[model samples]
Target: MAVLEGDCEDSVSDSAKSCQTQSCTNCGGDGSCNMNSVCNNGCLPGFYSLACAQSCGKCGGNGSCNRLSRFCDESSCLPRYFGPLCIQLCPLNCGGDGSCDFQTANCLQGCKSRFSGTRCELSVACPSSTCRDPCQSINGGICTSGCRSGYFGEICNRVCNCQNNGACVQDTGVCESISQTTSVTVPTKFSDGKTAYQRAPAEGDPNNYGS
Candidate 1:
């Protein structure tokens, strides 16, 4: 709804003409005649014009793009971002919003927590109290890989010391197939000598002679 630069034409003279009427005669609610009687109206938010059609490319702070050029206003892009559309991300670990200079790639405002360096590129180690795995400093400071033996958890902090010579699953710490524990459950056998070694769970016998 803001006034943007434009001019009413004089076909023969090829120049802007003063208003003949007192107020604007022809224009939509979104359009206007300026104080100087110049025909002007900024485009609706997200729309540049019928020629460009549709959304204005991610202007910073949700500001409207210029109606004609559609370029973002200077310093209008979000922090740590820049480019034709302001969709480009700043280098990793930049501090405040708009902190990364799109031109220089430096964190001019300093680094985010747990990240250090002129450009905020280095990862600072998290204390074991917060993140148990030393692996947090590596792999972009995320510990997604499974924990070492004898430990398990989201952060691989919980102990997995299974009791009685039991082996634990690295993910869930559930005791599983180990020396003393047998998952195989043999079925009960019939009294007859032939059925003594038959399948355990099946009723009667393999010969079907005895119940």
Candidate 2:
């Protein structure tokens, strides 16, 4: 009877030791063991998993992850980075001097003059500095005041080449005589600067032979 009782006490001790070992194993090193012997307290910030072994991937090293889902938390991207995982770079790097949209990665401000487009990659051509007026086109090829003197054409790209001291037409750019001639007569002037003239008879003059 004494031997049977001792065997029963030993069996109880062995069973208790096994339960303790199992409970300790259930604690995943990240959390303490609960009353039910389950690893349930969750991992520390920026880490997640049953063992707290996984890091928040591409979170710019400054973001936290959801303990249960292991996904990056909202608005956790570092400066110049965006997207849910903080993997995408900000647009144009904020045009190198601007701010970026945290969600869309678009430029917020500080874009250079004549720079446009979503990323500020497209540029508007400036007018020619030599031109006296604004350019009709952004290419600086066509002038609003037309070309300067001695130049002509749609964009004043052509040079005046008229001969015989003629002036060019504004619209057609054609050369023509500067002055016109008439047939009317006037009194003649002598070398001494005296005026001389001869009067012609009218049809109704009294000395006319036909009358």
Candidate 3:
């Protein structure tokens, strides 16, 4: 009888041990069947899994991440929205973060100044209405704002400082007139009985033979 009782106790002990092992394996050795451990706590709403690695659609406003389940709750603003479930307006432009003047989109400021064109895209302007020629000898030699060069005369044709006896050649420096010539004329006559012939003064002669 004593041996049978001892065997029965031993059998009961083995069964309890087996039950504990089964429970531990089912509960990950924590000894308690915690709902958090068994239930998919990490998964987002409408999602359930051992790993909780699934999407649950966009949370309406800012969502909160569950600490234990890592689930997103659509009860507030998102990170970029930065409010109670993402209900507030973004500080910068929601799309591009460009300048948002009075809630209306306009040209944003750019790196350069004095440019108001698209996307703040424009080059610097000339000082006046016109840009100067790159080849002028003197700075600002070419006139701007419709004031033209060569205005002193035709194509800048005004007389240069070169004066008296000096002639302005085309594109050449001034040149001066040099020598002058004078001439004298004398007359002589000869009668050939039929007519009288007169010879104009020969070069170096006061008169020819006066027959």
Candidate 4:
């Protein structure tokens, strides 16, 4: 008589020995003998999954998977393309006109017009000096369009050396040279600067800032 097991009917063939516990029919007793379970035949040479429903195609030669299809596809973006789908056109508004390979999310070949560094993430750094010009080396200034300490001129190039309580104006980047015994010098240059500096900070920097 056939014995009942979970969802499977266990029975011995007429010619077989006395009834015995049967292994899985799917894996052929490969230790994964469970009923209704899928087959894992190693599937072709590059196929995967127990059911082998996914195929990596010829692009799988490089051992890379396509994010969209989960198949073996190009690991990196192709020429002129740089995105997971290899769809982003190069030299777009990636970063300072940097060249971004959307496929890999990297700035390969080269960065945008003025951008530089990895992924074109770094902008032109300012020059070094006691009172470094905010936009010394780059077209824009560090503090945007504003007057520096002890300075009050177009582009904040003039020195005001106000010998009293003074402070730079907000937004306008103007300096208020308020001297104890002298009148305060109002600001002249207007601040007009916009930046998209990456929030990723150094090791000690606050992690929540970018969040």
- Among the numbered candidates, top lDDT falls to 1
RMSD of each: 15.8, 19.8, 26.0, 18.9
The superposed Cα distance between candidate 3 and the true structure at residue 42, in angstroms, equals 3.0
TM-scores for every predicted model? 0.35, 0.35, 0.16, 0.25
Residue-by-residue lDDT tens digits, candidate 2, 100-146: 56677666553444455565555645233423454443222345565
Model 1 CA deviation exceeding 4 Å by range: 1-29, 32-40, 97-99, 124-211
Model 2, total clashes: 0
Q: Global lDDT for candidate 1?
A: 0.51
Model 3 alpha-carbon drift over 4 Å, by segment? 1-39, 45-64, 67-80, 92-211
| Predicted candidate 2, C-alpha RMSD | 19.8
The lDDT, on a scale of 0 to 1, for candidate 4 is 0.40
Candidate 1 lDDT over 1-211, as tens digits, reads 2333345343222234433333333233455545453444544455564332445666666556665667775545666676656667777777666356645666766666566666778976633343434444333334355555555555555666554534456567665544333233344555564433323322232443223
Q: Against the true structure, candidate 2 has what lDDT?
A: 0.48
* Tens digit per residue, CA lDDT, model 4, 104-195: 55555544333445554566443223132344323322434544455443345444533442444443434453322232323333355433
Backbone collision tally, model 3: 14
For TM-score, candidate 2 versus 4, the one ahead is: 2
